[model samples]
Target chain A: NAGVTQTPKFRILKIGQSMTLQCAQDMNHNYMYWYRQDPGMGLKLIYYSVGAGITDKGEVPNGYNVSRSTTEDFPLRLELAAPSQTSVYFCASGLRGGGDEQFFGPGTRLTVL
Target chain B: QQQVKQSPQSLIVQKGGIPIINCAYENTAFDYFPWYQQFPGKGPALLIAIRPDVSEKKEGRFTISFNKSAKQFSLHIMDSQPGDSATYFCAASPITGGGNKLTFGTGTQLKVEL
Candidate 1:
């Protein structure tokens, strides 16, 4: 079902630059999420969407934005990138409720210089 | 607030040995716990999960032991192999709302030597 897919497998951005990490799921999941993983650290949520038009901030949402215009797409935007933003980003999708298991994408390795 | 806490930042085990990774949480609202395993350069994948109603759940060579009173849970790998080496993360979610809003603990890197 192509569970979850993310674009730009790897990327490097200069300070002040901006980019969007794309995520899609064919499972028709109603919940989508964006998370960042630092070296030797657990993943921290950046943003999430309950549905196409409902988005909310998570643990670490600074310097990031998200849009869920369609059930299949949830993209994360990083504006004015900073070195501290250098980390691996993952996109996941799940069913409607909180007990559902999430399907994750391969991940995008982003470097902000 | 670091809702979930995991210990043994790293572990090394001989082939065929059993490796256990531990985690604890402070939130009583969390009723679902799941473990994810991630290899280098890859995203984390669900291994096994247990709810507070069950004390143990086993899948293949992986097992999850949950303790409701202690607010703790653990993952154990039986007859560990080199392929089992990876970073394991324990996550919890509240019983309400979007269940996928997981609170993850620091990962435990497991290495199984042949």
Candidate 2:
């Protein structure tokens, strides 16, 4: 399987601009997640979905949104981007939601200017 | 609040040496602990993981030691190599609320010199 895949390996957005970071998994995972990594800060969950049509906020959900339209796709949206949003975003998928192995995509490097 | 804490922002060790990275957590609800390794410009990958039930686990040259009473855990790399140089992260997750949503600790950048 391709596992999890994310689009736009890199991007730079102006303040107030918006963009969507796309994620997909071929493993048919029921759980998908969005996380941001800032240098030594490590990964922080932004949003996650238990399944299609069920999305919830995570540790750092502000300034972001997510939609899981299908088992394979979970896309993260950044609206009115700010410089504070500059970080590397990752998309991950897992067979189950609790303490299971998560497969991560290469990640998208986003810079808000 | 940062529920997970990792130590040593960076570490450098020679090849064949054993490097240990430590982590502590404040959440008692967390039952699963896992470590992820990220290479430059790439997403993190699961290296090894352990549950609180097990005090220690070993997989190949990577090992995880857990101290339930101390709420602390550590990862040790035996016979480290240059290829093992990467950012390592310690993460924890509660059993409730879709258990896979992890809270991560600050990463430790490890550099193994040949």
Candidate 3:
């Protein structure tokens, strides 16, 4: 069913380069989120959307931006990416109510040189 | 405050052995507890979950035990196999807050060897 999918399985960028990480879901979920996983930092939320056209900042939103253009697409943008921004990024989606499980995308591993 | 805390940054178990991972939460408002499993390059998947109203929930080889008073929960992996080697994460969210937000633990890396 392609519950959730992420693009650019892997990428490497210089300290000042910027890029986008794409995430999409086919379950018709209205809630979507972006989280980054570091060695010991668990999963830290960077941004989230309640529905298309609505987005909000999460715990770790610095140096990152997100937009919800469609119910199935939420893309994350990194501006002036830094070495500290290098981490594995994950995207997840679920029903708005949220007691239900959130389906996660495979992940995007980005290395900032 | 970090709402959730997970123990044992890493663990190793022999095949067929039982591996347990514990997690505790400080927010009493959290009514939902979920465990997620992540492979080397994959996103975390919902392994099992339990609610405050229930003491335990089981699905095949995985189980989640919850304790409301202690504000804690745990995941028990029975008859662990080599393929079971992966990272486990514990998370908490308040059902009242529309529940989409999940506060995750640092994670536990489990290695089951033959």
Candidate 4:
């Protein structure tokens, strides 16, 4: 049940440097997300959480910052690392949102330099 | 503003031909229409979904064709293989918000050439 679980996977920040992009989930979801894939686009929703401590703000939430304390964690904090903040970062979980069935992970390829 | 609008960003189709992508939305309170599939580096999987009270929805060859009063939604990849190429997204969710996020579009890069 490693449903959703993302970690370093890959990173390279530089511009203003600030990291932290960890997400976890073992089912028991309650909606958690953080997407960013900008090459041809699609997948935006920068932050979301709807359970442990409730976080919000989506649609490219500026620099980005999230925290779900724990319901299997939700972390994504990229202070000033701008290179347009690179791309490819996904961490999803679901059990009460969108159209349900959304369990992704296996991604985190930041490269802001 | 790009509130979900995707089109022929790219497409090739040949393997068995039949690849349509199209997506459109301006939030008519969207009705949960999804389609995601990415390859080359992974992440982005949920391959098919539709619910505008259902105009169409298949699973085998992956199909979803909703048009809830023309807010639009499309994705049909019948037979086309080559592992179905990659990149294909079109999302819209608004079942009353609060956790039903997801409003994407601006992706379509299929190339099932054989």
> Which one wins on DockQ?
2
> All models: lDDT?
0.92, 0.93, 0.91, 0.86
Q: How far is candidate 4 from the true structure (C-alpha RMSD, Å)?
A: 14.2
lDDT per residue (tens digit) for residues B1-114 in model 1: 899999889999999999999999998999989999999988899888888999999999999999999999999999999999999999999868663689999999999999
lDDT of 4 by residue, B1-114 (tens): 788889999989799888998888887877788888888887888888888887998999888888778788788888898988998888888877679888789788898988
Candidate 1 per-residue lDDT, tens place, A1-113, comes to 87899999999999999999999999988989999999767999999998989999999999999998999999999999999999999999888668778888999999988
**Model 1 chain B, poorest ten-residue lDDT window?**
B94-103
lDDT of model 1 at residue B62?
97
| Worst 10-residue lDDT window, candidate 2 chain B | B94-103
Candidate 4 collision pairs:
A98-B100
Instruction: List where candidate 4 sits over 4 angstroms from the true fold.
Output: A1-6, A10-21, A24-31, A34-48, A55-90, A93-113, B1-16, B19-30, B45-64, B67-74, B77-84, B87-94, B101-111
Show the lowest summed lDDT stretch of 10 residues, model 3 chain A. Answer: A94-103
Clashes of each: 1, 2, 0, 1
TM-score top scorer: 2
Q: Score the docking of each candidate (DockQ).
A: 0.73, 0.79, 0.70, 0.32
lDDT over C-alpha atoms for residue B108 of model 4: 86
Instruction: Give me the overall lDDT of model 3.
Output: 0.91
- Candidate 4 residue-wise lDDT at A45: 84
Tell me the docking grade of candidate 1: medium
Tell how far residue A83 is off in model 3, in angstroms.
1.1
Docking class of 2: medium
My TM-score estimates for the predictions, one after another, are 0.97, 0.98, 0.95, 0.34
